[model samples]
Target: MSGPTRRPTLRDVAGRAGVSTSTASLVFSGKGPVAPATADRVRAAAAELGFSGPDPLATSLRQGRVGTVAVVVEAPLREAFRDPFALAVLDGLADELEAADRTMLLVAQPADDPVRAVAQLSSQAVDAGVFPLCGIRDNPVVEHLAGRGVPLVGSGSPDGPGMAHVRTDEEAAIGLTTQHVLGLGHTRVAHVSMNLGLRSPTRAARPDDLEAALYLDAAGRLRGFRALAGDAAPVAVAADLTVGSGEEAGRLLLDVPADRRPTAVVCQSDLLAAGVVRAAWALGLRVPQDVSVTGFDGVDLPWLDATLTTVLQPGVEKGRALGRLVRRALEGEPVADVGFPVSLRVGTTTAPPPA
Candidate 1:
């Protein structure tokens, strides 16, 4: 004859368990240690009262901490998760964020998306946001999130106002690679770069019918290559920064008349370099003996028959940097731009170019 069984409140549980509301709250929240017997009594009472727990929304509003980070990317959901560089960078960020007791909310911005997905930004629940290895120029997602006063950090350079950044020193990395190739006494050097467009005047302009458009990674490496090689640098763009792209680039370079072919090829990634080496062998050219190739990224690539002469950037370290930055921003600390240096690993991929 009761209208409907009244929903049990924390007070009902506390009253039934013969404890103060504070004790009942502590036991339920697991924020404090309680005697096993006392905890059991509270649970028993809560079960009898049909009270599961406090409402998450009410609790979040009171505490003002959402405990989630928004990881925003400039690609489709699948592509964002698939790309190796993106994966590595995110792995670093996620590992650190998890260690700090925060969760990740991955959001990918599609290229062909017409209406900016910025309408989805809501700091009403998330602690902060991250943009790893991509830009935010004309990006509504970033604008909306930051406009909502959500603290922001990026795995790469900050693309907008007040966003913290933790990035590898691309300029330094390129300079190191170029110097290494030059050190090998190879004057005819070519760059099989990643997609270009974000960082150069020649970005949107296709290098030729054969080259792919520019990307940020390619632009930074090309900048370094040109700086070191001067006016007569050899460069080509890849449709993508994959091993296949490297091999195709290698074949194309080799097909370039011998007098114009690059004796040393520097690729944007280890995979590309491996491909170039494979393609070179296919053309009956000896690595280092006929053409030297170098790659970026210290990723273990035994598939490459030759030891890649490359630089090892701390992928884990970079991830940790992003994590720390995210944590700092979440804690309301002023996060600044972080730059990690690169180390060179000289492998057998390079020798004096063919006599």
Candidate 2:
């Protein structure tokens, strides 16, 4: 056998069709206008010669538009995607980017090495970047990309640069939730927060607060609760933001004797609140009757019959805003820091403290 017939080339098609090389190039490139008849002849020749088109590498180089956007997350990929709030936001982002025919490159970097992942923007090549606001603080990833003049948009407010930020008003949401508990005539309120670390933004970490480090979101919610209460907000940091942590925190809070116990508990997330409710029931306490409970993030939890009085922050909107920001950055437009609105959803979970 003749070494599997030799591959075809543009020159082969041009010669076979009795057309100039430039004419063949024009026909395939679709740049210059060519007579319809001539174009048809070139196509026919290419088909006969089994020629496809130019190399993809050459085409990409010529276009100079990579169809990829980097989405950097500071948390583990499994945890970030598994969480309902993160999933909703990602879904919204994927929808917008897919509509625009752009691809998303998910980058999960540990808090310690955020730079390694972000450096991919320059080393590898992406049209733009989208990071969660918390991930952008003095983050190495943000610093590298911003240094390279790469366009950036965030799902949350990145502290260093005034990049396009799309996030629900976490402060406002927590404030409303806190006020609800306070309004119910509950003076002794305890907040169960997720641990983000003393280094996280949202809360200006006090030297003493460092002993009870929590995540950035947790810190912010706690700060908001304190600010709204006009008093030092007593907080118990959960090992993490999970139902188990909430349960443990609940037990710890309630063990403080009825007189000293908080009449109401504010959890950082819906999952945490649910855990607290379970803990309360285990202690023979009825929700909102013996002890009131509230959660942040309007996530659905059917098991808890009590309406979860919480903040309805727009998770999908945050994702969409981040996608839009990436598109704007790709188009060479500047993005400004923007904050989304949050609403309070009153549920039966919260009530006036027992007299």
Best by TM-score: 1
Q: How close is every model to the real structure, measured as TM-score? A: 0.87, 0.82
Clashing pairs in 1: 195-214, 195-215, 196-213, 196-214, 196-215, 197-214, 197-215
Candidate 1 local distance difference test against the native: 0.75
Give the per-residue lDDT digits (tens) of candidate 2, residues 1-355: 5578877888889998889989999999888999999999999999987789866666668777667777777777886865677777887888788877788888887665656675555576777678753543456666777776667787554544646777655667798888888888998888877665633322222446633532456556777777876546557667655677778878878766778878898887887788889889898888888899988778767766667888886667778877777777677677787777778899988889987
lDDT of 1 by residue, 1-355 (tens): 6598777889889999999999999998899988999999999999988899977767777888778888777666675554565678788888999998888888766545613456555433688888776543446666777877888887554367897777676767877877887886888888777766432311212445223422344566677777788645666666555677778878877767889888998777887788889889999888889898888877776555668888787666777788898887777788788777788989988888777
**Which stretches of model 2 miss by more than 4 angstroms?**
1-56, 118-122, 198-207, 210-216, 303-305
